[model samples]
Target: MSILGVDYGAKKIGIAKADPTGGPAVPLTTLIVANQKEGIERLQQLIASEGVELLVVGVPVSLSQSGAELLRDKDHLNKQMQEVLQFVERLKNTVTIPVELEDERLSTKLANGMQKELVKINGDDAVAAMVILQSYLDRKKL
Candidate 1:
């Protein structure tokens, strides 16, 4: 199965792809859009072009507290996550393929760490999608 992972954001969307054979998820491209409509359009084009059979979207949820700062940010984070779910709902409506939301806590941070360790590449939203997709793929293997 061809799976596409998406990291959704207000201004940009990150894309990554992997196959059922358990290959490494690769970062595709970042779509920058003015709004949700434009984002959906671009995403549809990507799904068509990439032959995606399933879509995995990253959802930021407050599942852990590593420090005191998290308590302060919890309310704001919850509100932001609600907006993300709204965007995910709209995206699901635009595609016929099955779409699933995976917990994406610390995906960006992990991507940043990976980028720093691997040198020679700049950081972008796509890296975060890679992290999300790879996590999903790994879980499926078990």
Candidate 2:
């Protein structure tokens, strides 16, 4: 089974793909967040091209407990997540794949560190999506 992972941002959505038969995940081109319609279209294209069996989305939760300020941010994230959830739901309809979220606390930072030794790095968003996907793979194994 192949899986598509996404790191959603306000401007750019990072993408990565991993197959159960393939050894490692590879980054795909970032998608500019147009409206939900365009976002779903872009993902459907990726799904068809990559043969995705599952979809994983990153959810940015806080590093610590919630407070008044944290609650405010939490509410904002919740609102934003609704958009993503809607996107995933729509994607699942077209792709007929399992769609879910992985706790994406600091996968972005970790992916950046992993790429630091490279000669050149492209979009961090796509790399971060790979990190999220790889983590899902590892946990699924356990």
Which candidate tops TM-score?
1
Give each model's clash number: 0, 0
Tell me, by lDDT, which candidate is best. 1
**Candidate 2 overall Cα lDDT vs. reference?**
0.72
Q: Stretches of candidate 2 above 4 Å error?
A: 62-77, 117-120
How much is the lDDT of residue 31 in candidate 2? 93
Q: lDDT of all predictions, in order shown?
A: 0.78, 0.72
- Residue by residue across 61-93, what tens digits does model 1's lDDT show? 633323234334545666667667777778878
TM-score of candidate 2 against the unseen true structure: 0.76
